[model samples]
Target: MHGRLAKSFKMFVLVALCMSLTLGVLSGLAMAQEKKVIRCFVQAYTPRERMEADRWDPPQYYWKLEQEYEKLHPDIDIQFLKPIVGEYEAWFVTQMTGGTAPEILWRQLGAAKADYVKDWYLDFTPYLEKPNPYVEGNDYWKDIFIPAVSESAVAPDGKTYVLGVDIVGVGIYYNKNMFAEAGVTIPSTWKEFMDIQEKIESAGCTPTSFPLGGAMSNPGSWSVRLLQDMMLDSKMMEIKTGVKGAKGVVKRTREQGGSISWMELVRAIKLGIYSAKDPQWQEQWKLLKEWSRYWQKGFLAAEDTDAYRLYITGKAGMLYDGSWQVKPTEVDSLREFDFGLFNFPKVTEESSPYATGIECPSIGGAGCAAGNFCVPLVVKERGLADETIDWLMFVTAPQNLIPLCNDLGSFAPALKVTEGVDPRLLPFIKQLERGSERIQPDLSILTPQYYQQHYRILQQYIGGRLTMDEATDKLQREMEKGADTLIDQHPEWGLKK
Candidate 1:
């Protein structure tokens, strides 16, 4: 009878212990549910399924940063949302219209910049002025970035919206084995660059996979801007007219390399200071036409991917691309020969009589950094604004940014004190340092609409559908139209009359 009693008591004790443990688990889960979830719709540096699929060297720095941030603020939960597959702007607008946009958004600068400027995105100027607690001796958050990078975050209204985390540098990537076999060295001048292309073509290889045609006009547009900027460098000071009657406008010296404001560019166009009929402008296009012979046949219709494939397949001697291609090129198993990169050869008097011989301004500016993310106004509505800024500050801190960029093997950290930059990116860093400022008249600085129009016109000119005089006349008219559009949009510019 005593033994029976003992067994019954033991069973009762087991039931009590199980109930206690179950209650404890339920309590823990309830606490976890209370955490404020921050959803990040990020790009380029996202820690997505790529982490799981890559067998070697999964980029875990972003994950690590999240874990560390969560540990520091246990009440906050950071979640990175997967990228939307198509038309991100449309989806973003839909989500925002329904008041359900994520806390952090990526690539808010392109077509959506104009729309989002109407309070869809939070202005980061106030936060950028504050000290970032994550970085040592960082009294001001804005001081940590390269000046050009920090300046890039500012919108037309002079309010900063995005925080860029990395810098992009462009170079001409060449198959080292092919270059050696052709007995050609990296060219220093535009003339020599073309000469080498001819030699490479003579060696039975396509000179370059320089794609000029695509729905995405960036590939063609980028080279044109660089060449135009170089050819017209002597006239930049005349064109970079900051907002008329604005105070504290720092006039750039003739040799200074930097960007001009859209207002300044519009004003320049309206004043006829940046006319397409300018000989320098005409020469830039002529030189591009001259070089088109070395590009792959049907180059005008080739997409960016087509150019990349041509280079990777060893049929093309060189690939014109940015630093972002490093990791993919390194890992591409199909590329049997080693590859090297060099900056676009500078245009000199030998190439164009209008060449100022001033170094071509750096193409890889603040825009190259894909980490230019912005917080939605919805995040503020959800009372998570401060937390989101804190998270951004932590991620952008030089200590964290360096490793993140290095792990990706692309782009240099855009911090003032970045250390341990990837060796592969050293050449790009040199390029950035070589040209501290970009020149104008940059159609891109105006608007996506005008830039697209300009690129299309350029394609027509290069394809022999239009004469140089006809093209320049059309281009000048487009500039005038662009200026008129801006003037109408912003009556506040006080120049509408």
Candidate 2:
């Protein structure tokens, strides 16, 4: 009887042990299932404080999307990693080459698309044709975006690799109180513009804030547009449209249509249709020199943020920045006075190429694809491509996007929002919508070496280190060298005659 009882106890212990092992194995499997993680590398879209606050409350746009996505797929997690603004390009490139790149990446400004699109980014053209599960009905995801937005991201190879979220327009932001106190109106011509600068300066405030300390400085592009607007004429327009010749002589075939192309700019350079030696070109340099005097003291040494701070604090009368400034200047920063926006004034016909006055706001320094994103090829290699693309589509839907646009205040949505935008941004939006006869591409789009040389000489010229003649000569050399390189790189562009 004792032997039988001992055998029964041993059997019971074995059964309990078996049950414990089974439970432990099941728990391990469940935890493994929950550990899925998706990584993203993006630029800072909202203020730092907002991101911190989001940890506790209902999340902001990015955070909200992340949280909702995680909730829907409880087994997966999303991580957004933001690199330092100045180091982002280098960091992204390194990560990509190392095969550790994040699944999603914000496209860097001035990054050569040809350099990475083929190897690093996944072509979304196939996915874009299909319907987005997040959007209503069976509408193609690409169809919802403004046509220009999608068109801007198309590569030379005709594949759409990047997606832009916002449209940015560059302009001047002015302190209304300073203008009123100085008795100056928004100038409509170059002469009046300079005169107002003097008046604002005489009133004991800096006329404007122009930062020249770095390659990414705002003044470099803004001033370039100003020069282009001042110097645009029939001859210039003709060359931009692929017509080439000396001063009064011009030539074009029916094959050379009226539209502007980068090739046209290159051909003009090669043929000397547009030359730094032109009298008008010299006049542009003179205008730049005169304009430099109105910039806040030490502007050449000051950072872009420093210039912005001076403007908002009333120490500067006008701020030359993009529509993106609206949020930071009006919403985030402290300001003692009302502010308004106005375009760079038109140059007189004597200074312009066209008999009709130049457009008030030049449109083309930056455009619809300012905030673009792309999925890295690594995402597909790692088997996360579908998940990553789906999340991007979800975040860009109207319901998700409109709130973020309201928060940003500076950019117009690439997607058409049936819901109204923030009322405060409408004025700036209207300014951007107004057309111009000529819109020059941002000079930064030039080859890096050329853009660097151009801006470096510009900084020297503006800082009194180089004379107008010296600056123009250096610029011409750099422009020719850049054109040569581009022609060699893309012979199909037909930049050469």
Candidate 3:
């Protein structure tokens, strides 16, 4: 009886061991089937503390989208990899070189595309043609973007690589009370604009705030606004459009050439279509110099933040900045005075080469569209391209985008709004609506190095360190040299003779 009882106990122990082993094997299999994590790296423009505080807010679009996306996509985990402030480009380069780049990354504006576009970014052309699953049924994804934005995103190779999210326009933000106090009317012509500046200055206020310091020493949006005005000249337009003999015009070498076509412009420079010696070019410099006199003393040494502060404090009468400034100026700065928006005035026929009937060309300044999010080529190798693109589209859809735009306050959505934008941003939207269809790519787009060189020259001229002749000659030479280098590198551009 004792032997039989012992045998029964052993049998029970063996059964319990078998059950434990089976459970362990099943758990392992479940773990193997867990969701894949998609890594994204983006430039963090907001402070972490601020983002965290607003994380639960409806307008905290980035965080909100992340939570919603993960909930909907149970099989996927999205992670935003934040780089150190001001060191994103460095970190991005390291990641790209080490073959560990995030699945989605921010495309650095003004960076040389040749450095990464072919090797690092996925060609989004195929994806852009398809309908966005996040959009309402039956609409193509590409159709939703504003026409200029859609067209601008396409590369010379006809591939769409970047998807911009917002439209930012540059305009004057003037202190309403200061303008009223000075009795200055909103200017309608270049002369009137300058005259208003003088009037404001005489009223004991700095006429305008201009910044030309920082890493690039960029002369802020005002300078670009001035350039856009100058570019509206009929001769400049003709050169950009490839029209034959509209004053200082030239012929195009290729059927694809237009007045503003990148290659055409490069060819025009190389072929001497128009030089710095041209009367139109000299006039632009003269106008810029004249405008400089009305700026705050030592304005060239001031940074963007300095200039912004001056205007917000009511020390300066007008600030020429991008639409992105609206939120910061009105809400963030908590200014005491009311401000009004105005387009840079029309360059009168007396001051410009264009015909009398031509109105101020709607110049979409530098940040016409917010920077885009691009999928790194490595994401495709890892088989996450579809998922990454889908995620981007989901975030950019109207339902998600509107809240983001409302929160930011400055940028208008790149997607057409069936409903109105944030009321605060309507003024900017109105300006964008009035913009000329003849969009000119930022000078940085063609050659960032040359663009910087031109800015440096402009700073010197503005500070009275260089004569207009010296500045113009140097600009033309630097541009030509940069064009030559680019042509050599991109022979397919058809810019070389």
Top candidate on TM-score is 1
| Of 1 and 2, the candidate ranking higher by TM-score | 1
TM-scores, all models, native as reference: 0.87, 0.84, 0.84
Which has the better lDDT: candidate 2, or candidate 3?
A: 2
Residue-by-residue lDDT tens digits, candidate 3, 1-497? 89998999899999989999999998876865686778866443221335543322222457777889988988788886655566666877887778798887776322424454446678877887889888887367877766655645556556656666666666788999998999988887887898888898888889999887754533443454345444545566455645556565232211111236566667667767646666655665667777888988888779888988898888898888777787777664447898888877767766656434344444442223444677777888888888888888887788887777777666777767647578766665555444443323345434767767877887788788988788888988887887787788778876654
- Candidate 1 achieves a global lDDT of 0.76
User: What is the per-residue lDDT of model 2 for residues 1-497, given as tens digits with 9 covering 90 to 100?
Assistant: 99999999999999999999999999988887666678776464532344552322222467777788888877777887754567666877787789987777777322534554448778888988989887888478888775545545556566666777666666788989999999999987877889999999898888998887866576666676556544655466556655544243222211111134557767777877666666665665667777888998888888878888888888899888877677777654468889988777777755444434645544432223335677878888788888888888887787777676666566667665545777665554455344432333444434778877877887898788988788888888888888888799777885563
Best by lDDT: 1
lDDT, model 3, position 278: 68
Per-candidate clash tally? 3, 4, 5
